[model samples]
Target: MAGASSRGGGDVAAAALRRCTATAIHSGADPAWSSRLTRPRERDGMVVVYGDARRRLERRATDGAPAVLRRSTAEEEEETRKKVTGGNGEKGEREWRVNVPVVGGHAGITIVPLFSQAVPKANLADEDIKAPTKRTQDGGTKVVQAKAGKGSATLSMAYAGALFADACLKDLNGVPDVVECSFVQSSITELPFFASKVKLGKNGVEEVLELGPMSDFEKQGLESLILELKSSIEKGIKFGNQ
Candidate 1:
C-alpha cells in the first residue's frame, strides 16, 4: 500500500505492521517515503522489500537479469552525442521496444536505463533508443498529464506492485530462477542501500547481481546518477532513522 505522507504514512504503516506477520513490500513514488515507512518494520526484525514503481518497471523490462552487452553502432554513438532525430529531421516516435537494463533510484535523472546494453540487440538508431530512455524517466509525468491532473499513477503503481509481489511469491515457493530488482541493504554500489537486479529465494535475496557490460553512454549515465542517488539515499537514511 502507498504511504500517505512521509511522517503520517510512516506512523500508520508502522502501527498497522505490528498487527500482522507478513513480509513487507513497499511500492511508492518517493524513496524517502518508503524508507520512512519500512525502517521501523525492518528494525522490528521483519523482512522488507523497498523499491519504487519506476525502478520495478525497469526490472520487469530486463527480465530480472543484467543483460548481455553488445558494442553500439556508429550511428547509435553519434545520436548519443546530441538530441535524437529522425531521417527527416523531425521528432521521432516514443517507443522503448527493448529490454533496457535500468538501475539507480526511482526519480528524475536518477532513473538510469541502459539502452545501449539492451538485450536481443535492438537494431534501432541511437535517436530511437533515446526515445524509450526519456519515456521511462518521464513515465509518471506523462500519465499525470494524460489524466489532466485529476489523478496520479494509480493503476500503473498497482501493476508494478503486483509484479514484484508475484516474483516474491514465486521465489518463496521455490520456483527456479526467480529474479527481480529491488532496493534492499546492498553492497552493489557505494551506497548503503541501492536498487539492482537480485535473485530471490526462500530466504529473501539470494544474490545481488552485478551490473553487466555497458556502452560509453551507459557508463556516463552510471557516473552521473551516482552523485544524485547518493544524496537521495543519504536523505532517506537520515529521515528514516529520525
Candidate 2:
C-alpha cells in the first residue's frame, strides 16, 4: 500500500501485512523472509528510499567520492552549483531538494539527515543547517500544517513509493550496484532494524553498507536518536505480537 501514513491507510497496510503473514504461515513459508518488501508509512520508509536513490542518480559527480558518484547532466550540475553557491559565490539557504542522506528511524527527531554528507557539498553554516535539519525531521507535520487538516503529503509519498518500487525491480532484474537506504534486519547497529544504505541484488539486500565518516554533528544526532528509535522499534514489536 502506497502513502500509508494516514490512519486509514496505515490500518489497511497493517491488515495487508497480517494477511501476508497468515498466508506465509499457512503455506509453511518463512514469514520473516528477506525477499519481502513491506513499505510501512508509519516509519517513513519511502522517504529514505527515494532520498538514497536521488543521491545515486542525481548527486554523484564529486571528484574522489565513492562509487555512488557519477557524471551528472549539465542541468543537474548547474542546479547543484547554484544551490550550493547561491548563484553569487556566497553560501545561502540550502535547497531542500538537494541529495541529503537521511539516517536513523523515520519519525520526528529520529529522522536524522546528515547534511554534512549531502551531495554537491552544501557548505552550510551550523546555524543554517539547524533549520533544514528540523524541517527534514518534521516534514510530515509541515505538510499537515500547510494543508490545514485537508490532507497529508499523499502525492509526494506516492511518487517516492513508486521510485522505491522501481529500484527494487531493477535490482531483482540483475541490475548491478543498485544501492538504496532501507530499514532492514541489520547488524550495522545495535537495533535489530535500522535504516542504512544497502546493496540490492537478486537475493534482496545483499550487503548493508556502513555509516561512512560522519561529522561530529551527525555522530551526535545518531547517538541522540538511538534511544527513541529503540523505543519505537520495541513498541512496534509489542504491537505486532499482540
Report the C-alpha lDDT of model 1 over 1-242, residue by residue, as the tens digit. Answer: 22222233444544443333223333334323322332434422211232233233333323323341111011011111121222112333233332445677665566666655554355555566555667666665565567664554555555555566667667766798886656667887777766667788776778999877766666676687888778766766655564
Q: List per-candidate RMSD values in Å.
A: 12.3, 14.1
Question: Each candidate: what lDDT?
Answer: 0.50, 0.52
Quality of model 2 by C-alpha lDDT: 0.52
Evaluated at residue 124, the lDDT of candidate 2 is 64
Model 1 ranges with Cα > 4 A deviation: 1-24, 27-98, 117-119, 124-126
Please give the TM-score that candidate 2 achieves against the real structure. Answer: 0.61
